[model samples]
Target: MEHKIQPLLNYISKYIVLSKKDEAVLMSKLIYRKYLKGQYIAQQGDVCKYECFVISGCTKMFFADEEGQEHIVMFSIEDWWTADMGSFITQTPADYNVQCIENTELVLFSYDVIEELYTEIPQLERFFRKIIEKAFVASQKRIVRSFSLSAKDRYLYFRNQYPKIEQRIPQYMIASYLGITKEFLSKIKGQLIIDQ
Candidate 1:
């Protein structure tokens, strides 16, 4: 069980050093979970119960508008964290849904547990703060890019960030993430092939 926690500890260590005692405090609070593909980890209008750190596989965080179309907010894979930040922080209803894109293994800490961990391990709080800061920065950049760049450019940026992800997921999911139609995505890929 402790061995299973090493990857998460190593990830946290990249942000802030964790004493073995601090690690134990954190490890005690963690609950490991596995989700099959197509399962919902968090749903809109419900409080996000846990802060999730991905150990393996992929998940999609998205918003489903009134028309019932899903606009992907982001993707999380190995070594990534996925949660509705506002919901997790405030214990309020989530605006986005987090769903498994592949069979996923995650290390989870509930909202109450996070508060407990913070008091027990100050470095844990600092590590989370850093993660939140990066997530916010990335969100802002994605918003700016959506306004400034064409769909093709956005797809290119995503490809650069997750080169092998395309082969793993459906083209339509990637298209939805880029705010484009699947047919339009096909056309864009065709154009890229010709350009190359």
Candidate 2:
């Protein structure tokens, strides 16, 4: 578990170098968590306490409507961060639920600890600001894709963006993420195969 922290440390160091003492201070706040497949990391209406960095396995952030249909918002795998951003930052109920898609290992940092770390390590604040900026850019791209792309084009783009996800995630979940019916997704896949 200790060795697993190195890669994350390296990632943070790229944005700002941390002294050994600061590193130790930062490390002390992180805790390892394990979740089984199908477990909820944060459920709808729950306040998210921790923001998780995936060490291994995958998670999906989704919302279930009144009809019980799930709409996938995002997926996180190795080296990625996953959390209900609205809930985590604002300390409010989450509209979406984050669930593990596989046996997952994560390093979690609580909101309070993160704020204190930013105070103590000014560079960490800059690091997170840059991270948030990148996240916003990605979100903008997703919005553009949803508005401008056909379902088939969207599927193709999603495949290109996360090639490994097809093997890790369920077809129905992918269909949800693409904002299409499962049957339509199946037809799209069939057409793709025939075209190939």
Per-residue lDDT of candidate 2, residues 18-118 (tens digit): 89888888888888889999998999999998888888899999999999889999999987889998899999999999999999988898999899988
Top-TM-score structure, candidate number: 1
Candidate 1: stretches off by over 4 Å: none
TM-score of each: 0.97, 0.96
Worst ten-residue run, lDDT, model 2?
1-10
Backbone clash pairs for candidate 2 read none
Q: In candidate 1, what are the lDDT values of residues 1-196, reduced to their tens digit?
A: 7887677888887889877787777787899988999999999999999999998889999999999999998899889999998998999999999999999999998998988888888777888899999999999999999999999999999999888677788888999999999999999999999999
Clashes in each model (backbone N, CA, C under 3 Å)? 0, 0
Stretches of model 2 off by over 4 angstroms after superposition: none
TM-score of 1: 0.97
lDDT for predicted candidate 2 compared with the true structure: 0.90
Q: Each prediction's Cα lDDT score? A: 0.91, 0.90
Model 1, residue 41: what's the lDDT?
93
